[model samples]
Target: MGVERYNDLFITEKQKIFISDFNNNVKYFPDNVHFTLAGEISSDPGNLGSGGGWHRDSPYTNQFKTIIYLTDVGENNGPFQYIRGSHKKSGYKLINKVLKEYDYGENRFSDDEILSIVNNIDGFKISTITGKAGDLILVNTRGLHRGAPLTEGTRKAVTTYSFRNKIPNKFYKT
Candidate 1:
């Protein structure tokens, strides 16, 4: 078992086109991109998935991501899961009140906590991304998401994170 990360990856022209259209803006650039191994996880609440528990990236800032699956992923291989429309609800007044004034912007939550929030939020649902090798998943990472705990086999994937503005190298190192 091993873990590794590459700061920024240079992609092909076609890949660039896909990302540009995915963001709906050509001004974005890759801030971080890397492949990692997602192994099985214990049933501990605090130690969940590759991205940890449900959370957003870059805090209040906007970000986009493309995850390319290098292997087959089924129900138990720690597929990436996301809460639909959670990004738009970040500032919804009623949902904020229902959360007891807790802001989830850049916050991580357990399944139970997220479920409670999802139950109350209208039109919110969890989407688990599963696919065969070479499949790619595009996501607005400002929304809530995480890798479901791995049960068997291995999940290998590369995540390319892009942003409208370049972030400092210092932030990427840590």
Candidate 2:
């Protein structure tokens, strides 16, 4: 879906509250927003049908995202998964080092790479977010996250992307 449809779906008071919370928590104004409908019946379980693999939304920048579930999400229905606390400096540095070694482009990480990064992090936890319609999750997209494979039903969700605007530094003569 597009921005208009996303705005329409996000009109309710609860949605407003959630969005407000996201803005406050992330301390940034959202510049871009979008929606997506997934998990239609398909014979082939390709990238489109199965959704994306494990990866960060923005690898270099600190971006914040809020996902609002429009339908019930279960473990078999392509739930959202995240590596907890992976947004911290240490976590990002560790992952960045591994990514550099692999020379991977700005794309999803392979299963082997995911495993290696997770193994390097101390006390890393994987959290699978399964919730009902209207459930909202705010995340630092710099961390490792992905949409799990859908084995049964579909998932409808809207995501808001917020980034910190860069201001040029002005130099002055002494």
- Point to the candidate with the largest TM-score: 2
RMSD of 1: 4.9
Q: Which regions of candidate 1 are displaced past 4 Å?
A: 1-17, 20-47, 89-94, 104-106
Residue 72, model 2, lDDT = 88
TM-score of each predicted structure versus truth: 0.73, 0.74
| lDDT (tens digit, per residue) of candidate 2 on 28-132 | 454443333322332235543233678776666667767777788888777889898776767766777866765423547887888877777677767899999
Residue 83 local lDDT, model 2: 90
Residue pairs clashing in model 1 are none
* Per-residue C-alpha lDDT of model 1 across residues 80-171, encoded as one tens digit per residue: 99877776655345446657867645366667777887888777778899998667788877777898877666677766655455544755
Query: Which 10-residue span in candidate 2 carries the lowest summed lDDT?
Result: 165-174
Compared with the true structure, model 1 gives a TM-score of 0.73
C-alpha lDDT of residue 127 in model 1: 89
Cα distance off (Å), candidate 2, residue 61: 1.7
Q: What is the lDDT of residue 106 in candidate 2?
A: 59
